[model samples]
Target: MNGIKNAVFTDKSIRLLGKNQYTFNVESGSTRTEIKQWVELFFGVKVIAMNSHRLPIKVKGRRVRSIKGHKKHYKRMIITLQPGYSIPPLRKKRKELELKNTK
Candidate 1:
């Protein structure tokens, strides 16, 4: 990963903020603007809007073990693309989007 090309966005609050968009787990510190720029550059489509938020950290424990490990808190962002251009559903539409960001 170049790690600087800006591929993902991270914001947790976006989960309930968006009406028609989905959120992705990304770098915790990433911002909505950076995501919009990255999406625009990679997918060749215009980003209509974006929002980001931090998810509350939750305490977690190891499964079936006495040891405990804290689950790290992360951020995610919800991005809205132009109505006409959309990233197909990931489950059944992987191939169609496989080459989209290949470069």
Candidate 2:
């Protein structure tokens, strides 16, 4: 569980959802096996395949030009689940709330 940071939702990721693939931000040091195990145990879904890659580190600095640091690096994991299984969409609740407020 600690290895997984959070679910990732983006234009590309949302499209992958239709294919039963889920994306997540994981700790940079986490391996595919570790992430697969954690996701399966926590979500109770069967993971068929896992693909992971590290995202590029971003540089950050203060306006003073003297202080600079690199943002925390993380890995992105794409997990494909067995047919007929799925994790709930994270944006569903937010969309519902937004619709309610707009009405």
Considering every candidate listed, which one attains the maximal lDDT?
2
Candidate 2 residue lDDT tens string, 7-102: 886767876877888888999888788888898899889999988876655345323322246445687889999998888765464455456767
> Against the correct fold, how does model 1 do in TM-score?
0.52
Model 2 regions lying over 4 Å from their true place: 58-72, 89-103
Q: List the residue pairs that clash in candidate 1.
A: 10-76, 11-53, 11-75, 11-76, 11-77, 12-53, 12-76
* Model 1: worst 10 consecutive residues (lDDT sum): 1-10
Residue 31 in model 2: lDDT: 79
lDDT of candidate 1 at residue 75, scale 0 to 100: 59
> Could you tell me every candidate's TM-score relative to the true structure?
0.52, 0.73
Clashing pairs in 2: none
Q: lDDT scores for all predictions?
A: 0.50, 0.78
TM-score of 2: 0.73
- Candidate 1 residues lying further than 4 Å off, grouped into runs, are 1-20, 60-73, 89-103
Write candidate 1's Cα lDDT for 26-72 as tens digits. Answer: 56555666766766786566777766665455336424322255443
Which candidate ranks first by TM-score, i.e. highest? 2
Report the poorest 10 consecutive residues by lDDT, candidate 2: 58-67
